[model samples]
Target: MIRKTDLFSGVIILLGIAFYYWILGSYFPGKKIVLSALIILNGIGLMVHIKYFDSYKKGTYVTFMGYLATLGFVLITTALELLEIFK
Candidate 1:
């Protein structure tokens, strides 16, 4: 019994791995974008897994909060950079 959200997470992970070998292995022009995307998407998958299902076990608090804080920082900095304020 797989939920849609869990299926989506699995798809993201599979695509990430495939893209890693295919996009990063050869002379792809958008390698930088692919690399960054793989990193972010994998993290997003983990975040989704954390949020969508299951009870919070012990040791995952720091990891969860750190991922959230990092995401927030990335969003804020990206916004500022887009506005030409955080150069």
Candidate 2:
């Protein structure tokens, strides 16, 4: 039961990350890259649960929220990195 909406949401989440990086065009050195990647994993997790679970009641909302919250963190971290705030 892989609904198109769920799949599209996953795609949009990835697109958001792509746009974020494209707009900044900055490379993360070491550990910082993990922060960016977590969002991708989160989005994939969201999609997987929705598609595979037979009756996942709250998986969709919870995973999507997690992705969004982490995306915010990624944006903040990227901005701080660009600003050379703590380096």
User: Which candidate comes out best when scored by lDDT?
Assistant: 2
- As a whole number from 0 to 100, the lDDT of residue 28 in candidate 1 is 49
Root-mean-square deviation of each candidate, in angstroms? 8.6, 10.4
lDDT of each: 0.52, 0.52
Candidate 1, residues 52-77, lDDT tens digits: the string is 43432333786456445544544443
* Residue-by-residue lDDT tens digits, candidate 2, 1-87: 766555655565575566456534555564345544544554565565456444444467885675465446445544544443234
Overall local distance difference test of candidate 1: 0.52
TM-score of 1: 0.49
Model 2 spans with C-alpha error above 4 angstroms:
1-59, 85-87
Q: How accurate locally is residue 53 in candidate 1, as Cα lDDT from 0 to 100? A: 36
Measured on C-alpha atoms, candidate 2 has an lDDT of 0.52
The candidate that achieves the highest TM-score relative to the unseen native structure: 1
Model 2, residue pairs in steric clash:
none
Q: Which window of ten consecutive residues has the lowest lDDT sum in model 1?
A: 78-87
Clashes per candidate, residues 3 or more apart or on different chains: 0, 0
